[model samples]
Target: MKLPDPPTEKSFPSPLHHPRTATMIGRWLGIAVVICFLTGLFSHFQQQTPSWLDIPTRPASLYRVTQGLHVLTGTVSVPLLLAKLWTVYPKLFAKLPWPPSRKALGTVLERLSILVLVAAMALELFIGFLNTLQWYPWPFPFKETHYALAWIIIGALLVHLAVKLPLITAHWRATPADRTPIATHPESLPPAITGLTRRGLFRTVVGAGTLVGIASIGQSVPAFGPIAVLAPRRPNVGPQGLPVNRTAKDAGVTAVDADWRFTVQGPQELSYSLEELRALPQSRSNLPIACVEGWSQGARWEGIRVRDLLELCGAPKGARLRVVSMEKGGFYATSELPPQFASDPLTLLALKLNGDDLDLDHGFPARIIAPNRPGVLQTKWVHRLEVLA
Candidate 1:
């Protein structure tokens, strides 16, 4: 015999209908997307302006990390976002027009805003992924398109958030509470519905895992080709054949020896001499350093990769790597390199920037050149490397 029809109207929803961990993740992901978009806009502008504009030049490493994290977060959020939209799809049909007695103008505007956000998010993430893999499918400059659409997306997001404020708050409040559970019904099925079961969980896990796996492999994958969608115009010639500072008297600075000492002591402590570092097997790489600040510079770097150095020092794994400036408290920064990058030969503790010796302003004796990373992670004037595991 068939079971009685599931309750259509109940005080509360079933576990499937109720907001679950995935929905919560989606809400946070939405918030994070907003923040990432804002920061990205700021970064885009900062990179576009010249050095004379007084905008702090973001280190190449910083650009890489922020943009990478932004992309990573977006990638991982995809499944959660889809699941959330699926669960809430029914709400779209509820006839709760704003100012119920008034015209449907507000409803139209709300619906339009939702459409923009959804479309913009999909386009941005998809285009962004393609750009990362160095593939430009469209003729238009991705940077220009991305910049123009960002404004639209942000505006749409604000309007959507404003419209949903009340419902969102109510949902959050009810989500955590225990009430009379309702039974599921066929009529409650959402469009493109997928059961919130093992299959759904497996899909999310696999999707997220694939993204992380690709990012990890990206460190050594060279032929990924030039997506160059957002890349500023490439320089025609190399280095302008600039002269190097040879003599201490001519350069007005004393050149330090390879025997020079380096220390890394903030939140942790460690030290390495130039010789000890050089004793490690040397690695050489020629990679383009792409700055989010809109300038791209290419150089041939030579030195021990940070990974080898870390291994040599027996630094504990999973520690946050902090590099201290050698130029008498000049500059310092921190980074968290994933295992793949940390171990990649291309990620060098560069003793030389370009073919010539390192300049004082350019991290004198040594700095780092992390592949596909923004300049910030490539800490300059690196005297000390601390691992705060």
Candidate 2:
């Protein structure tokens, strides 16, 4: 059996494959990429905070908003990307300049950059969306690969933009040509497929993007939960009416024994049994459990403040703290709380969630809940808090 011949530039005769259409869709896709990159950068730095940076400890839902936007922008980019590619894919078959001239070399380089951008972007989106689903079918480490690909995509995008600046500017606005259906060849004269005009393509792409956004955003917006068929998690669906990315069972954490106690190792060593912890002055914070995977919900959390605990333990002011958890076999089993977070009045060593003692899956004995922090860094099933200089 013989395979069919590959498609050429003329193989696709739709009037929609114009530079102006590519520009419009490409601009939207670019914006989405930029938004996704920035939000993902914030998330990355949250997990791996640099010494020079101090993540804020207010608005409590900052991570929730950013991560949600990260996922949202990434999701929206899918349709825009498809549209942009469809608009310009004919260029793939266009013959390059011959005789190995400087122009030919430049053309080759430009195409290579575009290839890198497309491949990396497609893989990045694939991995990123699946990450929200908590599924990793790929062998490569998801976080590292995803982070690295984001840089590659952005760099290639910049190169592409620089190379196509003139063309992009020329086609940035609607032109008279755009309003008229293009007839590049005789075969393309009679509408390749009925009603497949440029306007129709734009509407279809925009509609797809909107639909995906609506179906996926409910993971972060509880009001839209009913229509969130594409969402892997519902904002209000999990233990104590909140979602759980990592559970006690997965974390290798079990119910604590009667003798279990919470400890704070600082200038003054302190330990408290569960009842003793309950006896301490309690503060309530309406904070969100905002996961990096893009689901979040606000709930009342009651516990001792980290600053209060620091004071109780006679720790120095501005002391960084390490929260150690009973959770096993995970990178986030323990987390570091910087001084800003540790000293925040709303930061808590939470013992109760939503007015009830926490369930095991919700970090039963004790947990750390801080403002504007990634959910993974919230540190569940905490057993010890060690003060650092």
Candidate 3:
């Protein structure tokens, strides 16, 4: 006996289900994906610091801008992704070829790619946004999984682009037919009745992306801080007027006693007491402590410049250094300072923040402050600087 045929889906007309619409929305979404991916790559490299990759130390604000853009672009893509999915919802119901032919197998693979792309991209944005809140409710390792999924999403996206390239090219630059009636039936709602033409739908999607961006971007953009209510953090709303990723107590760091000393190990191994450090000539730099969590705040920092200390210790002008922190049992307990960062005039062993002695949580006594470096690499509660080269 022959098996019965499967039931077919009833096709419904969605005014926004046109190829031109998907093309237009996809162009912007593609741009967002590229920005998010590249910025994410930069961030991963910053944390991993492969031997072959040479990260720059100039302008001191390069990392700040790239990371801020990374988060902002990722957040805004949420709306774009939703709109793109909505536009292509009809495709989910498109009939698959029967009898398991070669063409049918290819169709299955293409659909599989779309499934992977959507799932990975959606999860990526979700976890990334949650991470900025410092919340981890997932079972897997956040960093490793996030990194791996990024590659999977990109790969699936490439496959999807290859499948959709014909359609994208056909409608990418075509003029919208505003007067075209969507349906002839009297009861059927057309663009004129719904007041949602192709142009109107495109504008609506763009508006959604813009709104999400403006609402959340303030966490990274200082100008938008007051209105970044949608973001997980307020730049100046944390303890001592700046958000804390890790506390001294949590890092197992306790208050130092009178015997506590700060040292520079080089040709001349020099050590200084708290009072002696305070007596040394102090320099000031207005720098922002930008975190990977997507929050940042600008503060006035005063201390001996790293280059100055290197000079005092008889270290070479462009030597790299290993900055050691008092905090224990953390990946950031010590960080490497590249030659350019070590020599920057603005890079300081910050002893003061906002005109007051450093808060214990904020790396009191001394901390590294270099332009454009991540907060984690700033090496808070610093006790030693060893010239590496």
RMSD (Å) of each candidate, 1 decimal? 15.4, 2.2, 2.9
lDDT-best of 2 and 3: 2
TM-score of 2: 0.95
Best TM-score among the predictions, by candidate number: 2
Note the Cα lDDT for every prediction shown. Answer: 0.56, 0.89, 0.86
> What's the lDDT for residue 189 in model 2?
47
> What TM-score does candidate 1 reach?
0.47
Cα lDDT tens digits, model 1, 1-389, are 99985433242243544444334445666765775686676556443544444333234345545554555455555654566665555545555566664457777777788888878877876776565545789888887887777788878877877987766665554332333233355576652453344234435655664555354323212222133223222322223321221222333335667568876543444567876666767778875564443234466788877766676667666444656554433122444455545666677788765676666655667777776565544666566676656
- Candidate 1 regions exceeding 4 Å error are 1-26, 50-53, 57-60, 92-103, 173-389
Can you write out model 2's per-residue Cα lDDT over 140-161, one digit (the tens) per residue?
9999999999999999999999
Q: What lDDT is reached at residue 15 by model 3?
A: 62
Worst 10 residues of 2 by lDDT: 187-196
Model 3's lDDT to the true fold?
Answer: 0.86
Instruction: Evaluate model 2: give its lDDT.
Output: 0.89
- The clash numbers for all candidates, in the given order, read 14, 0, 2
Best by lDDT: 2
- Between candidates 1 and 2, the one scoring higher on lDDT is 2
